[model samples]
Target: MKRPKTKSLVVYGTIAAILLMFWISWAGGIVPQVWQVNALLQDDPMLQEYPYKFRAVLLASGVATMTRPYDMEVAPFDFLQVIEPDLAGKAPNDPAMVAALKRLRAHERRAARVAVSHTAADGVEWVLDRAWYHKHGIKLPPKTLVY
Candidate 1:
């Protein structure tokens, strides 16, 4: 019987190690753990925001799951219906719900602006405002996605 080459053995072992690391990271993602902690341990912010940020996180997680189907499940806003049937029809029209959504979107846009500004200052100038592009003679790229 011929012996396996050491080089091939080393390559296979390295590949296996990489796969194991990926699997472990996927299995141990922090989002679910955060949910569990907030739900069970009564974290004040998570409790007070009940179903707003929680719902947002769920939708975000669901979208993330779409990108990594094997590792995630899309348990989005509809899950709120399952858990709190009272919120189904009423939430859409509720002033508080609308205000919460607006607040969340504002927070997201503010964070995006801050990130773009920092990146631009750090020489990722392509993402900077059109004013910066014109100042530097870099043609502004057509807008793609907003956030």
Candidate 2:
């Protein structure tokens, strides 16, 4: 049988090298994904109490996970209440949504501060999606349960 050419050998070597690198990274737990975040965001049971607080907790988690994205399985949400929508950019918040978010943030801050100072003092957080809010119509936040 004729031997393979050097060109074929080189191509095989390159493919093998790429595959080896991918395998090494996977074995070393170097790949980070959005699955865990989605799970935590979806399954954080305490989350049912405070809506929008989820956004803040997630923001905080993002900041915290800068070092070990792969090792980071799940983290809390943050910055929901403080979020300022950029209305003029590509992701511009609709005018009505921006106004609504600001109002919601204000409400969260007011309620949280009051509950923290007078009752728990820890200030619990909560997150509620727009769909859920409209469906169930929550009158209060997560902290209110503790109060």
- Which candidate number would show the highest TM-score if scored against the true structure? 1
What tens-digit string does per-residue lDDT give for candidate 2 at 22-77?
Answer: 99878654323223333443455443354443322222322312111011221111
Overall local distance difference test of candidate 2? 0.39
List candidate 1 segments past 4 Å from native.
1-4, 7-87, 120-147
What is the TM-score of each predicted model, taking all chains together? 0.28, 0.26
Task: For residues 93-119, write the lDDT of model 1, one tens digit per residue.
Answer: 477446544554454343323322321
lDDT of 2 at 67: 15
* Worst 10-residue lDDT window, candidate 2: 64-73
